[model samples]
Target: MANSPQSKKRARQLVRRTTVNKARRSRIRTYLRKVEEAIASGDKNAASAALQAAQPELMRGVTKGVMHKNTAARKMSRLSARVKAIA
Candidate 1:
């Protein structure tokens, strides 16, 4: 479908970017899952630690254009609240 050379190059770049983005998204989900597991275990300390670890990853997703700034902020807010509630 990409008849033009520029279009073909763009298609190739898109494929590479898609893989990278998928990896980034998966990594973020793994971090979030860790926090969820920590919270589920009812360990406030562990949940706090997990949330701390996930915060940067979530923000990094925002910076990398994998997620929106507000979306990341909202997720962080809700996760921190849940972490705080794990008493």
Candidate 2:
């Protein structure tokens, strides 16, 4: 329970931020899923394109603090290598 006026306002702000962060995370997941789908479909061109689009989105997630930079980097590296392996 928020006792003071400032605490109440902070609580409200937290709720709003939580919603925004949730949406951001969902969006990032959607982008990643698209890449995964493309890869699974075994279309090298489409997979590459999806990976291109997803890379920036993943980096943006890192910049916005939704994900860690190294995590994003590792994801990118693995995805790129997989993409490379696709004929």
lDDT of each: 0.95, 0.91
Write candidate 2's Cα lDDT for 3-73 as tens digits: 99999999999999889889989998998898888888889999999999999999999998889999999
Best by TM-score: 1
Model 1 clash count equals 0
Q: What is the TM-score of each candidate against the true structure?
A: 0.98, 0.92
Model 1 residue 42 CA deviation in Å: 0.4
Worst 10 residues of 1 by lDDT: 78-87
Q: Tell me model 1's lDDT, rounded to 2 decimals.
A: 0.95
Regions of model 1 farther than 4 Å from truth: none
Q: In candidate 1, which residue pairs get closer than 3 Å at backbone N, Cα or C atoms, i.e. clash? A: none
